[model samples]
Target: MYQKNPNLYLKNQVMSASPNKLIEMLLEGGIKNIRLGILALEKEQLVKASEYLLKAQDIVSELRYSINTEIDSEIPQQLIQLYDFMYSQLVIGNIDQDIKVLQEVQKLLTELLETWKEISVAG
Candidate 1:
């Protein structure tokens, strides 16, 4: 349902939206920032990468509880697993590992976003 118009769901749930919706938006934004951070890091902008990555992690952490409730159960579980992998990569400071985890996170979120879009359009 959400494969066609992700903007609908994303726009409908910005931070100004209800708490539950806000969490969902934060999750999407955080994932986006993570990707941005990786790109920044690739460009050797360590400081920028650190700033963005930290913010993304912070947002995700803040919404941990709410996300568990508002996100699709399967999605959250996959995110949890990915988060663990990401955190490990962060600790290990492995560029390859980070890239792999980032790819997985992006893929997962992209799928969910698409699903939301499909649902919005169908409804």
Candidate 2:
């Protein structure tokens, strides 16, 4: 969808993203991909779904480690809670519901990115 409907990814909005903000955006993008993968699985496209989900897992894994090293994160403490919830739901969610969650996650990351941009601009 991203390649086909670049608009769905909001390319212009993402292009304006700063470097640090970009990382969070990538994490959100990963979540979105994971949900899409689940949708693919529901549609019985196992190979495609696995591919997307693997990509998503790889992205989150990278970001999770990067956060540990790069930032003094009180956020991780919170993210652990969210991660647990997301994991639990991952096991339980149908494809449609997972996609909904992914969309929400994307919106949240976009907000975080914008907040960081605001701080940088202010400073």
Candidate 3:
């Protein structure tokens, strides 16, 4: 029986992903982290919550940086603003242990992920 290394498998997948697919993966990762953070917060595990929320924030930051403003200035600018808002909410939710804020961010990420999936499939 042969088992592939999980890390190597992930690296290969990432290497082969199209830009849109990469963005979709990032969105899914961010959403997963946010959900974990919320669960950790509910469990009164502040450290775990902080860690998960920070990962989600980092993903949002990556998405913001990946946007090409020169290609379409207005839309990219708007997306950057939305990402900034999500990052800010993640920080505040982690600090205050605010489940409501975390839920709001989760909703936004879900909507974005849905739209990204649609675009990826259509294009």
Best by TM-score: 3
lDDT of each: 0.62, 0.61, 0.91
What candidate 3 gets wrong by more than 4 Å, as runs, is: 1-4
lDDT score, residue 39, model 3? 94
TM-score of each: 0.56, 0.49, 0.93
Cα RMSD to the true fold for all candidates: 8.0, 6.4, 1.7
Clashes of 2: 0
lDDT of 3 at 47: 94
lDDT of 3 by residue, 1-123 (tens): 115578787788899999988998999999999999999988999899999999999999999999998884588889999999999998898889999999999999999999998887888
**Which residue pairs collide in model 2, if any?**
none
Clashing pairs in 3: none
Q: Highest lDDT among the candidates is held by which one?
A: 3
For model 1, name the residue pairs that clash.
Answer: 1-118, 1-119, 2-114, 2-115, 2-116, 2-117, 2-118, 2-119, 3-114, 3-118
- Which of candidates 1 and 3 is the stronger one according to lDDT? 3
